[model samples]
Structures are given as structure tokens and as C-alpha cells.
Target: SLFRGQDWLQLNLEELQQSTTISGLLLELVATRDIREGEEILLDYGSAWETAWDRHLKAWTKSPGMYTPAHVMDQVASKLRTDEEQKEYPYADNLQTSCFYEYEQDTATADGAASSSKKKKREVTTIPWEMSRTIFDWKNLRPCSILQRSDSHHHQGGHLYTVRIRNRPGLAPNSRIPRGEMHLVSKVPRQAIRFTDKIYTTDQHLPQAFRYPIGIPDDIFPEAW
Candidate 1:
């Protein structure tokens, strides 16, 4: 971490000297004075580091409201019922607008020659807001295979199963999780999706590369990630 205030320690470098052997380089920090107990240790990174830190602070800005762990921007955009509201949206810059075109081929005869293809007709339209948002129905999802079932009986009257969302054609790509990825979901005999009580007792149970857990509601999160 870069500190903008005064630092307690100073950085110093010294060369190592050896007899009847090759010398090596060494780096060390010598405290100017005694440091109080439980006091934070900070280093003076010099004028160059200070200048860079100042520049970063000047350019840094708060994150946009539309940014979230699970991208729910479409849901927010869908709330705008009228064109006036869509035009006046404060975060309209985050939404994407694309033009879709439909083309029709036409055949025409010229100078008694064989039928020739000509520029027939074309129609261009923008995707409606209703169709742009992704509607995920958990009830429609099913287990990928029978082998995905777990033998763990932790959830009373419920079973743990692996599930995934089928690929949907023409739908916008999800920014969070990719398509066809498996996820753990628990469900009772006659109920909607329920939360599972999966816990890690040891580091070996965790994935090789994993991110720290975030505080996000299960409803907002996509079915699979």
C-alpha cells in the first residue's frame, strides 16, 4: 500500500562482503528512531512514488452504480417504460444499442439474359428493451446428468445436484459466468431451488485458484457461475 502521509521507516541498501568467496548484494531498511508498539510500519518511497500516488488519486473515481458482482443492469434498464425515461437514464452509457437488419433477395431478368440477382429489399430495426433482458427461470433448468448427484445427505429431505443453463441462441453474452458451466444446487422433492450448506473444512477441498467470497444475495446471482 502507498502512504500519502509521513512514513516511519527509511529504505537503505548495503553490499555484502565475504572472505575467500564471491560477494553478493543485500537490501535492508534502517529505522531512523525507535517505533512504538503496535504502530504501523510505513516506508518513504521517495518523490517519484509520491508523484505517482498523487496522480492516481487525482484520476480515481467512484465505480458506476450499474457495476455489480452479478450484472443486473438489464433489470434496471427494463424499469424504464417510456422512451423519455430511457433517454433520460443517468447510466445510459453502460447500455449497449445495436442495429439489426433483415435482407430479402430478388431475381430480375435483364436484356433477355438469365435471371440475375439484384439488391432486393432490406429492413433495419433495433432490438426492443423487453427482448434484450435475459429472463432466467430456475424451474425450467434440469440436471445435466445423473452422475452429478452427490452422496452427501447433509440436507434433510433434499439432495445436492449439479445443474447448468443450456445455451440460448441470439441472447446477449453473460459477463459473469460462461455458458455450459456446472454449478451446485440443492432442491427438495417438490420445491424451488434451495440454498445448499456446502463448507470447506480444509484448504485441499478448495479449488486451486479461487477468489475470496463476496457478500451477494443468492437471488441476484445467476444459477451457474
Candidate 2:
């Protein structure tokens, strides 16, 4: 978890479930607004710790010296990306060349505006979940800029943009190569959107890029989804 005191953005689990990742849990950390090119992304880590403690920590601690294996964590992160799921996530189609979301007019009126006034507003055709996932999963992913605060109460928000080659390929099926970064900028009020459980379950596909070779369990958290 990227903890940034109270100044950090909220981790939207529902949103995270939309993207293809190597973890059973895909955490979508959204920016409150259009962050600048070089702003830092701060998050409230204590909140997540509190939630994990309430839900899983107590049970996790009972096992003597038992901790989540790194390989297991990596496998969970590298799940498959299916075609059916792409129908729900348009941004998944954008992974071929770039994973950035672009707003384009589907239709226009005689006045060179949207045919319907209600449709004139900028529509995010897709959320670049791949970009967000990379930022969170990649070991070598360096933010364009970072800022540190001596005190937690002093809030400092941030943003970033980067174009980099994949350090590890085949992390997920049909994963983007030479992936680029994109931000979910908003001008209107934020939507209360969340990802469903169906969107984040494990896939049957075998591991492709074996960076951390770990044995797959027969019953690998079958109930997690």
C-alpha cells in the first residue's frame, strides 16, 4: 500500500477489479481531480491496514510465522485477460497500442455538436485500468516526480505521466507492451462506481513470465472471488 497520510487518494476496489493484474485484489487508487504532470500520489494507508485487520489480519496472525508468499502474491497479480471481460471494459481494447482513454464524439448535430445535448458532455469511453495497474504492480515504475512532507496534517496532492517499456512481459494475457500512462481526470462530480467480484477472479491460464517461481495451490483461495 502506498501510504501518504490523510492526503492520499481513496483506493477504489470496485474500480480496481476492472483492470487485468497479477493480484487477486486489484486496487484502483483514483486521483480526486486532474493531478498535475509531476504531482505526488498520496494515499491513506492506515485506512487500508485497519480494513485488512478487521477482515483478514486476525485470521492471518493465528498461523505461526505464516505470511503471504511473494510468489503467491505475484501469481495473483498475473491473472488472465479474457475477451468476454473486454466487452465490459473498453479500455482493455486500448491496450494494444496505448492504454490511454480518449473522449471522441460518437455523433454530431447540424451545429457541429452532439446530436443530444445530454451527450455533449465529455464522455470517458474507457478507464485506463492497465495504466493504473502498472503503476501499482511494476517494480521499476518510477514516478515522474515525488514530494515528501515533514508533517502529515499538511496535505500535499500529486500526479504523474510516463511512457516506458515493460520490465517484465506476459504479466497478464495480451498485456500491453511499451505501456503508457493515463489519468482519469474529471470535471464533474465523482461517480460511485465499483468493480464486481466477477471481474477479479483468477484465470485457468498457466503462468507465462515466471519471475518468481512459486507452486500453485490446488485450492488457491477459491472463495476469494
Candidate 3:
């Protein structure tokens, strides 16, 4: 269904008149030249379609353990009992254990200071799922310098922080930074201790309109893609 070499057939659109029994439109694939026996039919779908397909092929990547049997995966998954064990396993690369934290703020007194019993209690929980690794190492990450403000109650004071991945050894001098090399600078409060992931049920917590699957069939995909 792609124009591999020179296209052997061309597309033609024919419109029928109102007086005819068949009054709609018909699309015909006419042969461009003489064809040999048992040759595959190829159509030139135009430049736009070809460009889009080329882009998709360039961006596509094979999923982890795509060709492996389900029984083999079940056998491998049964042995992994701990989170550390699962993280080190090669087959469980897609599976990541994310921790969730709950922060409880202490009550403020009439003197405009936090009470003496300002105990910060955190509830830690781990949830594992199939998530692609964005940052290879989280230990090397550090927050940027915070800008000081005279007015402490100001909304914009000391909120924004730029975080970067450290110790990138193989980068050449003066090369443009890759898109995945940097994390998004966000305006988060200094008091906020940790980030957590929330699980949403399909078509319930997540809207049905945004629940469409994204992928293309394997047959038409190019080998060099």
C-alpha cells in the first residue's frame, strides 16, 4: 500500500450524473503500464500521504518483548517479588515503582508562626505500572538556585526552580542540547516534599473522548523504519 519503487497504478475519481441509476462517486485504480503475472499492485497516494508515512516510520520503535510469548512473560514475572529485584530485571524495564507522598501542613498560630507541634508526617506508598523511563538516574538531579524575595507572602517568591540532569559524560562541546536532556522548569512550593502519580480508570476518571488507542498496523510498516 506504499509507493516502494515506481507506482504501477494511478487513482481516478469518476462522478455519476443524477439521471444514472448509480448517482454517487466511484474511485478506480487504473494500471499505469503493462504488468507481469503475479506482480503486486502499487498506487502513488501523492506527496502529502508519503511524507506523513515517512515521518511515522522514522519515529516508530518496537515495544519491549513484542515477539516473546505470554507464557514466558508470566514465568519471568512470577520470580520478581521485590521492587528492587523487578527494577534490576531486564524484562521488567517498562515496569517502574513510583512512590506517593501525602503532606500535612501544621496549623499557624496568632503570632504569624507555625505551632511548636509542626510535625511533618509523610505516608509513603509504591505503585508499579508500565511507564517509559524518562530520566535514567534520579540521584544525580539537583534543584537550581532560588531567587530571594523581600516579601515572603508574595505569590511568585521562591516558587520556580530549574532542575537539570547532571554528569552527561559523552556530550561534545558546543553541541545543541537534546530535547530529553533537560526537565521542565516548574513553579512548585519549597514546602512540597515529593511528587506522586495518580491512577485513573478508563472512561471513568479519564474521559472517553481522550481514550483512543494510538498505533499503526505492522504489515504496511517499512523494514528500515
Candidate 4:
């Protein structure tokens, strides 16, 4: 295929990390809800992809890589094998950061056939992704997600991360994952990886959605944009 002619080009999406506008807006809203450190946060992969692409366009004024369709597979190789890759991902069943990105490599299949096996994976990077970082007032900053994990994922059916902050569960009044709900998180594309998506709502619907009381300090964010 395309890589047959060029191999290094396989590193196409290596440089980008995507985040969505809705994510940015919601993050702010989450922060206002007094989000504390180490809360499990989850955003849509598609939205994240869109954000990353937007970042690329803003800079290059064109698609970052694709580099085009020919090389796209090489860019997203790791995520294919769910069981294997998912096991390697950071905070797998816990509440910590989750990363979703593709890495290039050579591999084999079941039939003893040798072929290219690109996989998309989720894992934690070297840089510790802190959920608190997003609360700062930065203009046009890069988009990423971080969380305070609580439970752990064990071989057997073990308990998940408790998702605490400063040793407290209710620290962040309005949690990235609703107070009593389960949150699905993964690692970010770039170095600081962490980790979904569905449902849409306008500002007016905020109250009934998460239901964190208004004006609560370190509790929940303002409903209006």
C-alpha cells in the first residue's frame, strides 16, 4: 500500500492531540462546578478527533496528515485489538487518565500470517495529566482531559477506582462523571492521555441533567454560557 513506498510517513498523526469545542465549553462549566483534582473525565472520541483536526487546520491550513486516506490506517493501528490493547491502556477500569491514540508497528495474525497490524490504544503517558490544570484561564489553549482516579481494574471482577480528590469523593460538587454515576475514561492522543460520547443539551437543561445545586462553592458550575 502507501507505506510500501514510504515508512516514516507512518508517523502522520504522531504530532496531533484533538479536543472538541463543546468539550472546551463543558470543561469550563465543569470547572465552575468546582471540579477538584483527580476526577474521572470522559469526552467523545469523535469530538476529540474533531478538535485535533481543527488544531491542525488552524496551523497548517489543511489536513494534518491522512497525511490522506492511503496512510490513515498506519496512523490508527493500535486500537483494533480490544482485549489486548485495552489491557495495556492506563486506568483501564479505574478512574484515572485514559489515552486513545494510534502507534505504528509490524505484527502477525492467528493463521501465522505476517502482515502489518496497526492498533489504536489507550494508556497513560509520562506526563501526569492533572484534571485541575484545565481550570486555569488560558486563551486558545490545547485541549486535553485529566482525572482523579479512585478504583482499580483487576484480573478478576475487582472494584473500580473510587475517583477521589484530596481524599474525598464529594470534593468537586459537580463531577465530570456525575456524582453517583459511572464514568468511562480513556487516555488522550498526545503525551498526557486520559479518556466517549452521546446526548446533547442546551444551557437551559443543565439543572435537571447533573443536578448539582447552584452557587455551591467547589460544588457545581454556572449553567449559562
What would the per-residue lDDT of candidate 4 be over residues 1-225, giving only the tens digit for each residue? 322313222333332133221222222333347656998866444554666656655654332222212123324432222333346653222122223311111111122222223432422112212344443322212212333322343313322222111112222332222233222223222222222111132222333222322232332333221
Best by TM-score: 1
Ranking by TM-score: 1, 3, 4, 2
The C-alpha TM-scores of every prediction are 0.22, 0.14, 0.19, 0.15
Query: Which should have the higher lDDT, number 3 or number 4?
Result: 3
Candidate 2 regions with alpha-carbon error over 4 angstroms: 1-156, 165-167, 178-225
Give one digit per residue, the lDDT tens place, for model 2 in 80-137.
2223443664322112211222222321111322222344334322122132333333
Clashes of 1: 0
Instruction: Find the 10 residues in a row with the least total lDDT in model 1.
Output: 99-108
The runs of at least 3 residues in candidate 4 whose Cα sits more than 4 Å from the true structure, single-residue gaps closed, are 1-170, 184-187, 194-225
- lDDT values, one for every candidate: 0.31, 0.29, 0.31, 0.29
Lowest summed lDDT window (length 10), candidate 3: 99-108
Prediction RMSDs, each to the true structure: 22.9, 22.8, 21.5, 24.9
* N/CA/C clash count, model 4: 40
lDDT of 1 by residue, 1-225 (tens): 243311212212221122233333233355789989999996555566667667756765655334322134423332212223345543333232211111112101112223214432422111111111222243232222121333464345544333222232344343122322322222221122222112231222323322333233444332331
Clashing pairs in 3: none
